[model samples]
Target: MSGEDFEDALKYTLQRKGWKLSTTKKTGDFGADLIGHDPKGRKVVIQAKRWNSKVGVDGVNQVIAAKAYYRADHAMLVTNQYLTNAAFELAKRTGVEVWSRKRLNAEIEANIPSKSNK
Candidate 1:
C-alpha cells in the first residue's frame, strides 16, 4: 500500500479501537500523520510509515518530536515494516510504542468481534 493508504487504514483501525482520530495535513505534519485521544482521553500521536526496509531511528525520533509538539501523553510509530534494533531501543527509552507489521496485525485482529459471540 502507499503511505497515504496505510495512514488511512491506521486511522480507521484506531477508530475501531475506540480512539478519536484526526489525520494531519499532507505536508508540514512534523512527523505525525494522525493525532487523537484514547477512550480515557489520553492524547496520542501517531506516525505511519509504509516501507519495505526496516524502519530506522529517524522515524522514531520524528514521532517523539511530534508527541512533544502536540503535547500528547503517548506516541506511536506504526509501520508496515519492521523496526531496526536501534530504533526499537530508542523507542523503548523514549516511551514510544513501535507497532511492527506483525504487532499491528495482531491488534487489528484482536479488535474484531467474533461472530460466534454475536
Candidate 2:
C-alpha cells in the first residue's frame, strides 16, 4: 500500500479494535500520524509507516519527538515492514513501541475475523 493508504488502514484497523483514535493533519502533524488514548486513558502518539525497506532509526526518532510534542504518555511506530536493528535498539531504549508487520497483523486479527474463519 501507499504510505497514505497505510496510515488510513492502520487507523481503521485500530478503530475496529475499539481504540479511540484521530488522524493528524497531513502537514504540521509534528510527527504524529495518529493520536489517541490507550485503554487506561493515557494519551498516545503514533507514527505509521508503510515501507518496502526495513524501517530505520528515523521512524523511531520521529515517534520520540511525537510523544513529546503531543505530550503523550506513550509513543508507537507501526509499520508494515520490520525495523532495522539500530532502529529496534533505539526504540527499545527510548520507550517507542515498534509495531512491526507481525505485531500489526496480530492487532488486526484481534478484531478482524478472517473470511476463512466462517
Q: Specify the highest-lDDT model's number.
A: 1
Residues 28-97, model 1: lDDT tens digits: 9988999999889999999999998999999999999999999999999999889999999999999998
Give the worst 10-residue stretch by lDDT in candidate 1.
105-114
How well does each candidate superpose onto the true structure, as a TM-score? 0.91, 0.90
Candidate closest to the true structure, highest TM-score: 1
The lDDT per prediction is 0.92, 0.90
Indicate the residue-level lDDT of 10 in model 1: 85
Over the stretch 16-118, how does candidate 2's per-residue lDDT look in tens digits? 7677899999999888999998777879999998888999998898889999998999999999989999999999999898889999988877878678989
Quote the positional error of residue 76 for candidate 2 in Å.
Answer: 0.3
**Model 1 regions lying over 4 Å from their true place:** 112-118
